[model samples]
Target: MQLSSTTSGKAGSNPMGEGAPIVYVVDDDISVREALEALIRESGWQPRVFGSAQEFLSHSRTATPSCLVLDVSLPDLNGLDLQQQLASTRNDMPIIFITGYGDVPMTVRAMKAGAIEFLTKPFGDEALLDTIRDAIQRSTTALGQEAELQLLQKRYASLSTREREVMALVVTGLMNKQVGGKLGISEITVKAHRGQVMRKMGATSLADLVNIAAKLGSSCGN
Candidate 1:
């Protein structure tokens, strides 16, 4: 059988749009895939179904909030293997595993690997739907944090060498005079660099700068 990605949603809606949340269903069973596609579409999510792990992996990924409804047993790579791969590469995407032969150790492994939920086959529709909802919420939060970090890094990169030095010392509770002494510069020059750092980093106050520094993992001694 031909394996490809198919999106399920309203007729005119673009499921791959930036704001639309996508749910991926990777199950070898055609009946299961069909059922999930209908369910996800009805719940106002875009459903992308694939017949195997490889097919799903080959599909291009979008940055929007998403969760995977993955079957534990697939034709190419098993669900556990797929989970391990995604854990390293796409940690922002939450996973909910569905399996017919789920056992204690299998469920434990999946959960320990950061899977949001594991459901044995014959699970209720509401239970799976609720888990998907929670997983998407987590994905949304992770994506937001990742975007924020990228913006912070961009802003930090725009700093001059001296401004970076000043910021590093300022966040370490050093006075402007002390920073100037460390850098062998005048206090007025240090203050100027500090103001530039604040303006470029969009920090409103010293405390705010410190917080941003912490988030950026700015090395104090650098």
Candidate 2:
């Protein structure tokens, strides 16, 4: 049951890039797992199947951005429980639930928990594929935002106390002379600190520095 051999729409397109954004299938049914693995591969995604939620959880890499095709009824951990566990850990991976017998209340619960889609058994291949594509796009965007936040945090961590003060003043639209006056430092000293702040923060322009500060939600001054 290889998905790569199937002829689906634009099977060559790997939207999330090669070997990234895998479609993880977690189901207790062996046949369902194999079938889904084939389907995902055929849609030009890397697929990994697990027979139980525990197996999936053990094998998952927390940092990797991926979408889950989870069965609502699992042997060890059910889909809802797994979703809650992932949420507790702040994992934002998008989930699409597949169930053999799901009612309106169950679907409502899944949707409220941030599931992208709730698919019943005998679901259409196209519907599942579309939902997975949407989920992948969202996951990619989220991962990129997280990466940017991490870089901002690292840059912010590199600034000295005085340099941080200078940065805050600069982003607050203060001139070097005004910043020096406020901090009781000479303009020459303020200029040096400004240069150091720019270099340490990897900001090419004052606007860039301001944007980074805004994204980090850090106060410009004490």
Local accuracy of candidate 2 as per-residue lDDT tens digits, 1-222: 223333222212344456566888888877777677778776777777787888887773646567899999999999999988887564457999999899999999889988989988888888889999999888888888989888878888888999988988899999999999999999999999999989988889999988988887844454
In model 1, where do residues sit more than 4 Å from their true spots?
Answer: 1-18, 218-222
Judging by lDDT against the true structure, name the best candidate.
Answer: 1
Runs with alpha carbons beyond 4 Å of true place in candidate 2: 1-20, 62-64, 88-92, 218-222
Clashing pairs in 1: none
Clashes of each: 0, 1
* Residue 52 displacement in candidate 2 (angstroms): 1.6
- Please, what is the TM-score per model? 0.91, 0.82
Model 1 / residue 139 / CA error / Å: 0.9
**Clash count, candidate 1:** 0
lDDT of 1 by residue, 35-83 (tens): 7877777788888888888888988888989999999998889999999
